[model samples]
Target: MLQIITEKFFPPGERYETLHRAILYTNYRVMRGEKIITPIGYLLPSTGLHSLATLTCEMLEKQEKYPDGPKLGVFVATTGDDLLNDFAAVISFFLNVTCTPDPDLTRRLLLAERPSLGIEAVPSRFIRRMFDKDVHARDGEAAALTAFIKQLIGLERETFVGAMRAIRQFVIGSHRLADDLNLAYTLFVTSIESLAQGFDGHVAEWSDYDPRKRKKIDGALKDASDEVAAGVRDAILSNEHVALARRFRDFAMAHVAPSFFRVEAAGAQGPISGPDLPIALQQAYSIRSSYVHLLRDVPRQLTISGFPEATEVDDRKTLSFAGLSRLSRHIIMQFIARGRIVEREAFDYRRELPGIVTVKLSPEYWVASTGGFDHKTAPVRLAAFLEQITAAVLQHQKDAKLTDLGPILTMVEHSVSGLRKPSQRLPMLTLYFLFHQFAGPEFSCKQWPALFEKHKADFDAPTVESFVAHLITGNRVEWTLEQLEELHKTYFKTRHTASVTKIGLLLEAALSLYVAEVNRLAGNNARARALVAFAVDSHPGHAALRTYEASLPAELAEINWTGILLPPRPSSEGPSADPVPAA
Candidate 1:
């Protein structure tokens, strides 16, 4: 029956994929109630004989005499679920149950056919006895094969040998029914893992291996995977065209096609260089290179697609400090790919922190190359970029749902316009991302110290200090203008703090008119009174009016009350002055 199936379904020297698929198809037909029966029925002689036993004996004999003879038994045994089980039973019975110590038969069986059937013949014994005395006779041959493989993996050897070793193991092991293709498949998929292990364990030996071996293994795996895929496609070709083709195309794109370029850039055949980098950025770049190059023990793979233009070719200059920072790895990869680099003068002094500069990658070559000199609406674009940074930062924090940062971004947008234009957006975003780093859930004063430290160079110390003071006071007053005044008044009264430098800072520019008026009437007692009145009108919290009056000389506080444009004081000696001041 096995012979008939093999002759009918499998051709000579057909690949494993074809045989496996044909068997699967035959099994499917049987399950679906096909009336077809195998033609080689006489080998069984009677229904009393175990079909598996007869099939195994015949296949063994044929294979020993003719190793290249056809692999028909696999198709017969695996196709019929019952046949495979019975085959194992019969083979086990002959090996152990019959208890015949015939050395020639065992040797012939072991040496005659391929190991694939022998593997299949083992699992039927309820327990594996392949390592027992009966199977031990073949150990010498197996050990030789294993030793050859061990040498193939050694370092200082040719990579081609390593690849050949793997392929040989796959082919030989696959031929055995009990070979555990799953394990083989796993090791096969990670051919690189084996190479890496060889490279680590025996570097000197691995060095002797062929350099082209890695490529060979990669090619072989890809070919095998492709063949498996083709078989799958053949089995399902009639099912769906568009969908199946699309799936196959996707699979091929993912596994077969190499999307990344793996060019070596070391020693002399390196990437194009650029201006020399500053020492600080150089250290950072070295770290970046190690990460990108897979110098570490753990394997790391990064997709360079996001940075298609990255890849600096050798033969140029190293990047400058500013260039290094301004050109992030993404941009650098592009630079490498393009054989170009950024200029040092392009970095802005105030905003050129390594963190900021490093994040400034942009594919917008126009903006990146011109350094922001050409665009008519560069300011607007700059603003938009800053807003993007703010949005990304806020995105990292969400309970507030502050989707629109237009107002605050608008305030700082001009900071980067014209002479202030930044070459990259990454730094801005990095800064923004960092904003939420130390910020409390409420984005409160917890971040003030660090914020001050970071921005101190860019912002006026007095200005930020006063702003913080105002915020603390403002928050205390629920940010209401009226409450702000009341709070100031209460603070002065309770704390006996006469100075209002902080408040004055908050109101400095807005109070210029009042300051000019006070200086105009300097040393005039009555004018001082008018000045105090003006202060009170502008800031009702300037309830310290009498204190201001006392601070001035008595004459200045009294001044000429009659002719001046000042309104009359609420006098105790006469009727109050008119509500309206003199025109």
Candidate 2:
């Protein structure tokens, strides 16, 4: 149970509080299988004290997120995350009123001294900051926990993991930091920074965002003085948020509604009644710097309601914590509603990798930006290289249970003749789906080579051979590179064309490198190294082979070798009655 560590305990009030020492005894019925004393109890103060702690505790303990929290090292209420979630409710209640709430004594809760527990009473940077912010708030954390929770759960996950951190700061500051009106007011602004930093990634293609030096080096820019340009470029590049305050105010103004500024609390008019959000929000962010770095403090009374005074449009206009909160929360909710991506400007990073090939095609296009490839246009010899890389990933997934696949047992019930027409893409894909499936243990040497040999005109032999090598290594299928042994004996003895010899070498290297990656991920470094060396030595200078060589460590490990790569089907129960297809 939690124990109060403070020397000064507020005197007991009229309502129910926690059991002795203000243990969150009310929130948790039973902790770690041991009974804690009392319920709806608080370590109270005056009239308001008992209601907040009691109501907050009851409401918090019943949330859907409660049971999902960590039960281990949990001392007192729930984990720190859970406790903060409970406290966030208090912030919601505060939103119901619009001012620097009257000074109320909030009691403390500390984990009891258990030498065995590793975590302290507080946890992680986010929670620790939150705990400190929550310590002094007297009121308003009562009703809105559900709304916040709803907003949190509904966010788009790709960016939500990031936005949640900023939201946590806003929640705590909205309630507790209000005690220091400036801290609370600036926090409303700081939360915007959190969103900006989390997702406002650089757009590399936008040359304007690039530093002058980079553009100069890349040959797209020039400056009056080389030294002046050189000295400041790196510094400019390093601070990703170049015009952070301006960007934040700009982005918030565009998204947050003006109506939010005019909102009234208990019939009291809000400060900045006219939508001068750009100036007001900008002033709020400037204050964040001094408060965070200089230990600056501002009077709480000035922010009770930012209105006619904040509306002056002057540099010194102070934003009320109440008004800023409305502005900040509205923008944050709009951000969430817009699917979690921040609206801020960015530098030096991006949300997604640029496409290798801009969609348009050119005759001599750089392969790096692959103008294009099609079955008809792609070089036939490179088929083996593509096959090896694709099979490596497929096999790794099947082995790791990351994917489930069934054993390959039979020939497809299809006519190879139908696959001959270039227009028949579906039939071609069917032939493709059949590629490695025939390489399973039972059909190892039989169906795969037989099918490919008959349909050689539709799909290349080198591609078939590469996948067969994958089957051998992946299943320990008791087969060696019979085709490689054949090619080794014949290639280059009498060079035909340069393309012919190069193709043979690349085919051998793709097989070697694919096996090398499989072995490396399997922890057979010796085998992996041998395979890598063989791959590099075989072609010696093939670009694709070398790229795969360097990527040995980057490949993700996969499992199972499950004997069942595909999830088994009920009708297809085991293998069919005969290992051969009816076709």
Candidate 3:
């Protein structure tokens, strides 16, 4: 029966004749109820049943001469009954299934054929033993083939697979099944748009339009009266088309086709690039809109005479649709490629610290330091540091005796107000602490006049001798008229020169000596001594402070200070300020 069927239905060729004999031999087993097993390689077009049969016949013709050689039974016994049944099923499927090849089936056949002559024929003994096994295996193979086909076509491998499938279907002419170019175009555009949305999610800025609109609405509500805000929100919601148009324009203008509007040349006669993508997309969208809305005019023109007219309007519309499809594919693929590059190049945004922490002394520390008047507007790092420092300071302040901190705090606040840079504030505050340690907590502006007054008699000579004596004595007295006038005009006034006379030397020496002792107690002895040395070497009066240093009380000179060491204040040429006694 197989021989007759092959002779009648199969094409008359060397290929068909060999395949015919293999089918006959396989069929004979089924008739005899003998099991037959088939190798997957026997399904290959070049090396399948035809090749197996040709090899088997060649071996058999020589068996008469050498009877002990390979036997035909070896090949026949393994070409199992299951293979026959599968072959039958395949045939029935081809006959019953639609005339058009199933994309899935075609894909499977291609993969099954891919192994470059590596797959081998089954051995008879093993084939007999696994006849039923091969039956189940065949079913599994079918499923695997379907999977392999999907893989081969590169579908279901990414987020944009559905879009790709639509494109693939159109390219392969499967779109003809529906014979609806309009619907095909719609699906292509829809898929492309879906891909664009996927691209948007992976990118920055492009993904923000909708959220930004919502944010705008949220912000408006904060300023509007309840009823007015509600009305405004309703108005915005009602005008979604306007918002969508604006968003589409922004995206199309920015990324997909930025050069869509550029002139082709540089001159007055240079042609303006026309039929712009944005405009084309607008028209494409209008067509889609017309289709969706079932506009009376759209259906009449689109369906007339079973085809669109060859008019200029129709040609332009068709061209626009084609352009949009091609553009979408280009844009999606470009973004996907861009997204990959971004993924490869992305880096962590965290920054390393500079290893120096500035302590904030008050609740408004960051504001005062940064000059950011409003706390909400402070720099992120500054604000964070402020919080950390404020917490630490408050915690430390809880344990420490904060006596006479009021005057010192006032000085710090006043100095901070005068400072320009945030970095300068911390060092200025450190200077305040050095001054507090030098003059004691009782220090304030009230003591200024008294100290100057005590030097009044010395200033009679208008000489340096009187100033050194006053500092060495540490006198407490109100400022006399002559002393106050001389001190204010000479030392405190703007554009005043450093007092180089004996009085100036004595004041500078005393200030530098006190600064050294304060810094030494704070554990920065080296820096403190360096500062004193620098002061003494730079100015003549500063040397007098070292000379008077030994005359200070032992307790004042030797008190043990235990705390974090503060960095030295930056150098300045003028004399450090005199201590102001607390009011």
Candidate 4:
């Protein structure tokens, strides 16, 4: 624990913009909740949180920060900093444990201290800025809302903290992206998925296949080679969408609240009782899958957030986003309350490490914005290069005909070789997303006629822009210049869509770096300089490219490539933005 607490720091002249952290004790108290102790101190038993004022506040006589009115909840953290995340998490864990889903729950989500006019700064980096002030939840409208919470529950201190942390983030996300309904809904589901991953009895079922056939299939795989068996196993389990959907729905059903069907939703929204409940629940997960893999839209009712918000999709598969949001919170609450213990050693304390790389559940699994990174941290900046490339691959996986996936694997293999483990925030899936963000759906890219030759390989690598500008351009195929040029235009250029997204900009910059490396290796220093210069321009403030440019031979480093025009090469992979979720 960093014993020295400090208020949110702002640039010298922006002290007025500096928001102070104030812990106001609300009238609400935790019921059946016991005191929780951490290394530095213990949370007031009723609140399940400890408030430590910053040193700056102790020394200065600052103007009043928050309003004089009383706020919501047992624990309300009014911070203009990252610490609000903790407030959300603690409140979520507390509510979950206590089974007190107050109808005014949304009021309790006041984590950030934003100016009433809204956040003024144009974000220059990754950040988590505001808290949702949506109408407070009306848990009483749904009978099952708080039905599952048990009395006198005992959860391991570690399990309690971990659940709190994960929920805080996902809940924040649900509110943050509430406007982008699909992504917001997905985040809500992912929050539950994160909790489900390590759930007890979370058996690694190969697939939800017929048991009779499954037994034979298991036998068939008995003597198979490791790679062959593993591949087969993966193929068999590829329909995890169903398993996950059923897992969610079944989890809900297995613990059906005693009063779940006692009443109808307040609005004329379709019924979620009897068969409708499970169907809507399953459909919620189904809608989540559609948005995830195909970017599909949600049912109309689900898109609009409202009171008595649970909508029945009688004509289609559906659960209102609000309905799902409330459901997810309940599931999480029940999950944390039911989970009495998790092995103390099971916690990934690495998350608490002081390293610049702070691993979080992907907002892309309930991931959130990471903070505290700066130019001094080389790996975080360098990791962005690969991170963006992974984003590109995932974005184009379906349309880019980018079947030459092996090249990026080699690129990642080469790039990550000397990287420290801490710097490797890259998720395990970077076939660009192998670093993070990629969910390993079978992506589509144009395959050369002879490429089915790779069917037996580990994965169908969506190779670098179909090998036209692949760094190892000639490694596998003998492409005549004409074929290379034609393929490059038809696939990489024509099929590519323009993107103005932040991720798109970074992907464009990364591809420029990708080409720069290729050109440099090819001894085309001038072109390499042009590419690097373009990359630097596209993604300003990148440390890796800047360092590489600074280290250039003194004479060449002095040469300006900015004004010089270079012929466009047929092999150049240009910028195109495809929406890639966070890695």
Structural similarity to truth (TM-score) of each candidate: 0.16, 0.35, 0.24, 0.38
Model 2 ranges with Cα > 4 A deviation: 1-53, 56-148, 174-182, 200-239, 261-270, 273-275, 296-316, 340-583
Evaluate all candidate structures by whole-model CA lDDT and list the values in order: 0.28, 0.41, 0.33, 0.41
Candidate 2 or 1, higher lDDT:
2
Could you give the C-alpha RMSD of every candidate to the true structure, in order shown?
A: 33.4, 18.1, 30.5, 19.3
* Backbone clash count for every predicted candidate, in the order shown: 58, 26, 15, 25
TM value for model 1: 0.16
Residue-by-residue lDDT tens digits, candidate 4, 1-583: 1111121111122122223333323223322333333321233323323221111111111212234333562112223333332432444344332111222333333322332222221110111112322122233412222232221113454455446555764555544442355676777777666655545344446666556777898799898898998788777676543366666666666545544444323432343555666777777778778988998876665443343335557664456554555556556666665665422223343243233375533223222123433212323323343444443443333233222233333334344434444224222122333222222333332332122233212122323332312322223334443453353334335333321112234455555555555456556677767766776676676565566666777334333221221222335555333334334
In angstroms, the error of model 1 at 481 is: 34
Ranking by lDDT: 4, 2, 3, 1
Candidate 1's C-alpha runs over 4 A off are: 1-150, 157-176, 179-423, 426-583
What is the lDDT, from 0 to 100, of the residue 423 in candidate 4? 20
lDDT of 1 by residue, 1-583 (tens): 2222323222354333212111110000011211221221111111112111111111210111134544654321233333232322222322221111233433333333333432323321112232122232232432432333233222222332344343333222222223442332232223322333332232122223334753554455575677774564444433322222222222222222111223312221222232222232233334333443554311111111111122232422332211221222122122112221221112122231112244543312221223343233333333333333222321222221222222222322334333342223223322233333323344323333453355434322222122222232222112333333344344334322322212231132123223323334454334435545554454454334434534655444333211121223334423111111101
lDDT of 3 by residue, 400-495 (tens): 222232433454454554655433343333323333433443464443434334433433432222333333344332444355335423432322
TM-score between model 4 and native: 0.38
User: In candidate 3, residue 185 scores what lDDT?
Assistant: 45
